[model samples]
Target: MSIDWDRRHCSRKGHITYAPDEAGLRNRLHASTAVGTVWRCLRCGDFVLGEPHGSGPAELAPLVPRGRALRDLFILRFLAVERVLRGVLVVLAAWAVWKFSNSQDAVHQLFESDLTAFRPVADHFHYDLDHSPVIDSIQKVFDYKKSTLHAAAGLLLLYGLIEFVEGVGLWFAKRWAEYLAVVATAAFLPVEVYELTEKLSWFKIGTLALNILAVLYILIGKRLFGLRGGHAAFEAQCRGASLLEVEVAAGEAGGTQKEPLPVRQRSSTADPA
Candidate 1:
């Protein structure tokens, strides 16, 4: 009778076909028969297979999870710099708002024509001397005078709060955090670009470029922290291999009355005692 390989061991009967491994755990093909297959084990990271006789037969790639050991150090440096930059931005913005609010004389000087003539509207406000067509246009869209400092303060605080939250989430490798960071950073890009065009300064240009880089880094480099297609495939391959092993072991044990197969085991540097 032809030995039914299908009915023979754990490796043959699975939804996904596994290659044979000879150097598996303890190296016994089957407890009774010497027949077996060879494969690499992902768990133990070595050649794995049965001896001359064994029941379970499955092949797998040795798993070696790769990551930069110094990656966290780089990340720590990035956060430290970011915190300092954030503090400076807040301080500058706050000072600008405060300076613009209480300085009536400076406001008048801005509207003064040749340091002498005030516009017709200056008679009404006394400080409209500095008002120009640009200021007039800005006022028409949104007023930000001394009286509205409280409202402006609230808005600035809200903006800073959102940015701070995004930064914290990004540091933790959370998927939702990455998404939030991407959205928040992207939302500011257009406005930043406009500011860059309006005035080409080191500060403005640098801020715009930094924000753009942050957006791209979050969305592309990390795949939004594994919310992408590649991550799904990687996870699937890992889990699929695990499930295959379990099924093969159960199948081989049920099929024959022969003794369990012997397998070879190896020690690795990464393994713990």
Candidate 2:
């Protein structure tokens, strides 16, 4: 089923109605009813009750997003949310790594004591602590040098910061943020693939897929890197969604738009009875 992105956004954010200085366009966008005046919402092109949100020249009208533009914004915000989550999670992981590095000795001692305590019980159940995969994983971490652990933590923190920047930029729909996200995501694809090669997991696969999709969607849909006529074309697509821009473009192209018919009046008496 098709989604009405325009109406969906308007429902959440409320209608954005404008009164243009140009009489022709203004009349087309507003109307008088028995109750009061209503203005046409730029976002949904629907007449709404009450005064307009803004009054200005046609050129000064707000570029309220609709249709595919709204959909694109929706997708970008979704990616932004994902980026924010990644930023938070990685930052926490980095902190955990740093803390673990600082208290390695204490942690190692505690693990040994606990393992010793569990040894008799494990032996009774025919479970060998020495060969346990989970225990081996922890022991291997203890094998890392303090400096190595600190370095790993630093890298994670830096990556988290980058993700945070991407998230904020994308949430605001900034062009530079789109470029940054594309580059960062593309650069990580190889690492993600390599990880999958080492150990196959659903979480890893899903993250990789989302990153890949984000990169492609931004690059192609946004016309980045001269693809699909680049930045100019992208801006043009955005402007096309604006009614004022459409009227201006039509004027420049020598095309005339037909104004809407006037509202009908109900006759008090029967017609020519």
Using lDDT as the measure, the top candidate is: 2
lDDT of 2 by residue, 143-253 (tens): 999999999999999999999999998887878899999999999899999999999999999989988888999999988999999977776676666665655555546
- lDDT, candidate 2, equals 0.81
Encode model 1's per-residue lDDT on 69-111: one tens digit a residue.
Answer: 1132234236435744674576567666656667745666564
What is the lDDT for 87 in model 1?
A: 47
Clashing pairs in 2: none
**Residue 204 in candidate 2 has what lDDT?**
96
Deviating ranges (above 4 Å) for candidate 2: 247-273
lDDT of each: 0.47, 0.81
